[model samples]
Each structure stands twice: as C-alpha cells, then as structure tokens.
Target chain A: MKYKVTESENISTVFLDGEIDMDVADNVREVVFPLIDSGKEVHLNLKGVQYMDSSGISVIVESNQRAKEKNTKVELKEVSQPVEKVLAMARKFL
Target chain B: MNTEATNLSEKKDFLVRSSSLKDVRSFSREVFEKFKIDENLREELVLAIAEAAQNIVKHAYKDYPDTQDRMAVRISCTDKELEIAFFDKGKPVEESKVKHRAIDDVKPGGLGTFFIQEIMDSIKFKEGDKPWINNLVLTKKL
Candidate 1:
C-alpha cells in the first residue's frame, strides 16, 4: 500500500492507497500507530483503497482501541465502497 | 444477460503466503464477473473466499512460513447454489477447534471466521482425498 500523510496542527490525515491484506496490515499499523502513539488525532483517508480483508479490519479495531487508551482518536474518512462493505459486516464489533 | 452456462466452475492455485491473498481475491472477482453475479453480492462472495483462503495462510501453514506449498480454491456455481472448496497440504485441521470466537468478544483475530460463517450458508471441513491434507467447503444459495 502507498500512503501519504498531511499534518495540520495536531491531526494527521493518512491517505492509504492499495489493497490491504495480511501482507500489508503490519505496514499499515506501522504507519498509523506511531501517529496515534504521539497522542494526535488521526484521520485515515480510504478513498484510494480498493480492498481490505479481515486483517485490515483488525488494524482499524486495534487502532481505535489504542487511540482510546492514549486519549486520542482515529477516524475513518472517505471509506471506499469495498472497504465499507467489510466494515459494515463487522459493525457490531466496531 | 446469460453470460455463462447454467453451471460454471473455475479453480486456481496460489502460493500459500499472505501476499497471495490479493491473487485469491482477484481470481474470485474474475470468476464472479464471468458468472454475472451482481456487484454487491459478488463483493461479499469475494470477501468470504478471501477470508477462507487467508485462514489457510495464517493458521494451517503457521509453522511452514517459508515452505513452497500451494493451495487451491475451487468455486462452482449452479442455478440454485454456489459452492467454494479450498484444498491445501498444510496441517490437518481438527474440526472441533475451528470455531470463530464469540461475536461479542470484540477482538481482532477471530473475525475472519465470523465473516465466513455470516456470509456462507454452511461451512464444512472434510479430509482431502489424496496428497492434500485439508479441505474446507463453503456453500451459499445463489
């Protein structure tokens, strides 16, 4: 996956582009976690993401939990149709 | 449009690695398109197929990360139902140990199996006939 991050004051918006699976979940965490650890609100822009599997969903859930622990928040933005469908399937968990 | 015959089947084999998950989804999407499945349902089927394939890579081959083993995915569709079968030579799966965690647990790792169970009408684990060691069959009414 290719990602671009823009920082505006405290919030960092991460633009993730590509298919997300187990192969790329770690990289995604590596990118999004540090920002969350810094206690900054994070926005994940999923407009360019074409597909995401259960592994990717795990990253989102873990990130949300971690953000809560650190007193920060992670928001999903511009979720693509494919990714949204999977997220919808796991709505109760979220 | 009736783009395909009444009965259709396609199968593909891929390296049993996390990276191959994309190829698995691609193959599934292609087959669904050829079968003229609607977009929304097609995506759900692809997600179900990919999750099952991911289980093979994550659980079955957990010990053989660098092994050169490959797994096969077969999708067959008829007028009334669609069946997907996965063939792998990885560790034998004890059917008793293959349950998805409780949905209310709100955990990360176990959601794959939950999604599969939610999407497919029935899931069965059977012994492979030959060199293959594990076979998971999932079916849904089309």
Candidate 2:
C-alpha cells in the first residue's frame, strides 16, 4: 500500500492507497501508529484505499485502542465504500 | 443464488507468500464475476477468500519463508452456495487449534479467522490427500 501523511497544525491525516492485507499491515502500522503515539489526533483517510482485509482492519482497531490509551483519537475520514463495508462487518465482531 | 449451477469451478495456484495475496484476491474477483455474484457481495467474498489465503501463508507456511511452495485456491459456485477450497503443502492444521479470538476481546492478528467465520456459512479443515498437507474448505450461501 501507498500512503501520505499530511500534517495540518496538530492533526495528522494519513491518506492510504492500494490494497491492505497481511503483506502490508506492518507498513501501515509503521506509518499510522507513530503519529498516534505522538499524542496528536490522527485521521486515516481511506478514500484511496479500494480493498482492506482482516489485517488492515486490525491496524485500525489497534490504532484506535492505542489512541485511547494515549488520550488521543484516530478518526476515520472519507472512508471508501469498500473499506466502510469491511469496517461494518468487523464492527460486528468488535 | 437459488438453483445450483453445475457449471462453475475455477482454480489457481500462487506462491505461498504474503505478497501473493493480491493475486489471490484478483483471482477470486474474476471467478466471482464469471459466476455472476452480486457486486456488493463479491467484495465480501473476496475478503473472505483472501483471509483464508493469508492464513495459509502466515500460519501454515510461517516457518518456510524461503521455500518455493505454491498453494492452490479452488472456487466453485453452485446455485445455492459457493465453496472455496485452499490447498497448501505446509504444516498440518489442527482443527482444535483453529479458533478465532473472542471478537469482543478486540485485538489484532486473530481477526483473519474471525472474518472468515463471519463471511462464510461454514468452515472445515481436512487433511490434504497426497501432495497437499492442509485443506481448508469454506462455504457460503449465495
């Protein structure tokens, strides 16, 4: 997956592209987690992401939980339809 | 999705590596398209299939990263249901050990199996006959 992190003031928006599976989960976490750890609110823009599997879903869940622990939040923004569907299904489990 | 179609079975083999996940998903999408699966459900099916494929790569073949093994995925659709089978020559899957973590537990890593269980109607793991070591079959009603 390809990603770009745009920082405006304190919020960091990570615009992720391509498909997210097991192969790219670590890379995704590497990109998104540190920003969350930075104590800044993070926004994961899924508009460019066309497909996401369980692994990708885990990244989001883990990020949110991490944010919770850090007293910050990782907000999902402009989630693509495909990702929204996956997230909806995953939410049933969460 | 009602009458069983006797005419739809397609299969493909890919290297048993994490990088092959996209190919696995692409193959699934193509087959689902030919089977005329609804566009909405097709992506869900693809996610299910890809998760199963990832299991084979991440769990079954976790020890053999450098080995040149190719796993096969077979998708068959009948009017009533769709069956997807995964064949891999890796560690034998212990049926009792194949459990997804409690969803409410909220964690990473184990969600792959959970997604598979959610998307498919039933899932079974069998001892692969001959050249294959593990056989995982997932079925979903159309």
Candidate 3:
C-alpha cells in the first residue's frame, strides 16, 4: 500500500492507496498510529483504496481505539464502494 | 469462457503466506466472472474467500510463516449453489474452538471468521486425507 499524509493545524489526513490486506496492515498502522499518538485527529482517505479485507478493518478499529485513548479522533473519508461494502459487513459485528 | 456454463470448477494453489492473499482474490474474481456471478455479490464472495485463506496463513500456520507450505483454493458452482473449498497443510483446525469473538466485544483480530459467517450461508470443517491437514468448505445458495 502507498500513503500520503497532510497536516493542518490539528488534523492529519492520510491518503491510502492500493489494496489493504494482511500483508499491508502493519504498514498502514505504522503510518497512521504515530499521527494519532501526536494527539491529532486523523482522517483516513480511502478514495484510492480498491480493496480492504478484515485486516484492513482491524487497522481502522485499532486506530479508533487508539485515538480514543489519546484524546483524538479518527475518521474515514471518501470510502470507495468496495471498502464501503466490507465496512458495512463489519458494522454488523461491531 | 462460457458464461452460461452451469457446472464449473477451478482450482489454484498458492504458497501459504500473507503475501499471496492478493493472488487468491485474483483467481477467485476470474472464476466468478467466468461463471457470470452477480457483480453485487462478487466482492463479498472475494472477501469471504480471502478471509478464509488469511486464516490459513494467520492461524493454521501461525508458527510456520517462513515454511514452504502451499494451500489450494477450489471454487465450484452448480446451477443452484456456489461452493468454495480451501485445502491447507497447516495445523488441523478445531471446529469447536473456531467461533468468532463475541459480538459485543469490539476487537480487530477475530473479525475474519465473523465476515466469513456473515457472507456465506454455511461453513464446514473436515480433515483432509493426505498432503493436507485442514479442509474448510463454505457454501451459499445462488
């Protein structure tokens, strides 16, 4: 997966591209976690992401939990259709 | 490619590792497209198949990440039902212990099995005969 992060006053928006699976979940965490640790609201832009499995969903879940602990927030933006479908299924379990 | 073919079967094997999950999905999409499955359901089936394969790489072969084992995925379809089978030589799967984390328990790790259950109609685990240890079958009515 490829990512680009932009920072504004107190928020970091991470734009992720390519497929997010078990192979790339750690890389995603590496990119998104420290930003959350910085106590900034993080926006994960999923517009370029073509596919995401449970592993990807796990990253989002863990990030959200981490943000809550850090007194920040994580939001998903421009979620692609495929990812939206998977997220919908995951919402059932949440 | 016969889109109208009612009875179809395709099998492919990949080295058992997290990196091969993309290839698994590619093969699945090819088979589903050739079989003319609905576009709306194609991605869901792909997710279900990928999660099952991920389980093999994650749980069954947890300790053997660098091992040179291979797993096979077979997708077969008839006029009324679609069946996807996974054969892996990793550790044997314990059926009774394979439940997903409790619904109210919000966590990351156990959702793969939950997604499989949500997307597929049935899930069955069997002991493989030879050269394989775990056989997982997931089916959905068409």
Candidate 4:
C-alpha cells in the first residue's frame, strides 16, 4: 500500500492507494498517528484504495476516535465500493 | 495460453483464493455480483465478510510467518442469504470471551467479531484438531 500526506491551511489530507489489510495496519498507524496528534482537521481519501479488511477498518476507526479526542474532525471522502461498505457496516456497530 | 481452447473450456467458478487482505474486497464484489445480490445488501455483505476473513489472517495465523500457512476463505450464497467461511490451521477462538467483547465496546479495535455477528443473521465457529474453521453466515432479505 502507498500513502501520501498533504496539508493545506488547517486540513491535512491522507491519500491512500492500493490494498489495506493486516500487513499494512502497523505502517498505517505509524503514519497516521503523528498527523492526528498534531491537532489538525483530517480527511481520508479512499478513492484510490482498491481493497479493505477489518484490520484496515480498525485502523480508521482508531484514528477517528483519536481525532475526536483532539477535537480534530476526520472525514472519509471518495470511498470505493468496498471501503464504503465496510464503513457502513461498521457504523451499525459503532 | 491458447485463447480459443481457453474460452471453450473455461468453467465459471465462484471460488476465490486470497493470501492478502487486499484481495478480499474485490473477491467479495465478484461473488456478490455473480449471485445477483442486491446493491444495498451487497455492500453490507462484502464488509462483513472482509472483516471476518481479515481476522482469520491476522489473529488465527499470527504465529505462522510463512504465506503458505495462511487462511482460506470460501463464500457461497442462496437466493436468500450469503454464507462466508474461513478455514485456517491455527488456534481456535474462545467463543465465550468473544461474545463478551461484542456487547461491551463500541470503538473500532475489538469489535470485528461482534460486527460480523450483528451484520450477518447467523454466525458459527467450529474448532477442532489441527485446522480450525470459522464460518460466518450473513442473510439479507431479498
């Protein structure tokens, strides 16, 4: 998986591409945590993401929670069919 | 690769083999489409199955570093519901402990199993010698 981080003004956008699975969870966490901790508004772009699993969902959810704590809002944008489905199902439980 | 022979002899098979989590979503979409599953239900079923399959890869086979020992996911559906099963040669999960976690938390990390249970109509886990099979059955009213 490949991720690129870009910041403009008060919003930080994380553009994710490729597959998000168990193998990439730790790497994703490492990249996302610092930016989130910096207390900037975050937006996750899933347009290029080809796949997603529970591990990936978990990472996103955790990031959302962290962002919430810092009063930073995290929004999901341009999600693919698969990632959108995962998020929808997750919303039922969370 | 003989194109003519391949086209003539090709059999339509729904089975998907995945070693990485990346393949799960795409495979789920293919299976859902083949079954003529509804658009709304297709979304839910894919997510539920993806999460279940990912858990099998992450926790069940954590000790096995080799890709050869990874889990296998099988999905089949009738007119009413989609059934997804995960087979792995790894440790069996404690059902009692898992059930407790389902109701306790709403956050992201520990709720994979719970989310699968709630999204799917029925969930069954079978544990035995050497290889353990975790099956998740999801039903969408069509």
Question: Which ranking of candidates, highest DockQ first?
Answer: 2, 3, 1, 4
Give one digit per residue, the lDDT tens place, for model 3 in A1-94: 8999999999899999999999999999999999999899999999999999988988998899999999999999999998998899889878
In candidate 4 the C-alpha lDDT for residue B45 amounts to 70
Model 1 clash pairs are none
Label model 4 with its docking quality class: acceptable
Question: Per-residue lDDT for A62 in model 2?
Answer: 88
Q: What share of the true interface contacts does each candidate keep?
A: 0.50, 0.66, 0.64, 0.34
TM-score for each model: 0.94, 0.93, 0.96, 0.69
The worst-scoring run of ten residues by lDDT in candidate 2 chain B lies at B101-110
> Per-residue lDDT of B1-142 in model 2, one digit per residue for the tens?
4244455899999999989999999899888877888777888899889889888887898799877999999999877788999999999998888888776564445788888888889999999988999999999887
Model 3, residue pairs in steric clash:
none
**Candidate-wise lDDT, in order:** 0.88, 0.87, 0.91, 0.66
lDDT of 1 by residue, A1-70 (tens): 8999999999999999998888898999999999999999999999999988778888998899899999
Query: Which candidate leads in TM-score?
Result: 3
Global lDDT of model 2: 0.87
| TM-score of model 3 vs. true structure | 0.96
Query: Model 3, which residues run further than 4 Å from truth?
Result: B1-3, B103-109
Whose lDDT is higher: candidate 2's or candidate 4's? Answer: 2
TM-score of chain B of 1: 0.92
Chain A only TM-scores, each candidate in turn? 0.96, 0.97, 0.99, 0.92
Best by lDDT: 3
Q: List the residue pairs that clash in candidate 4.
A: none
Could you tell me which residue pairs clash in candidate 2?
B3-B79, B4-B79, B5-B79
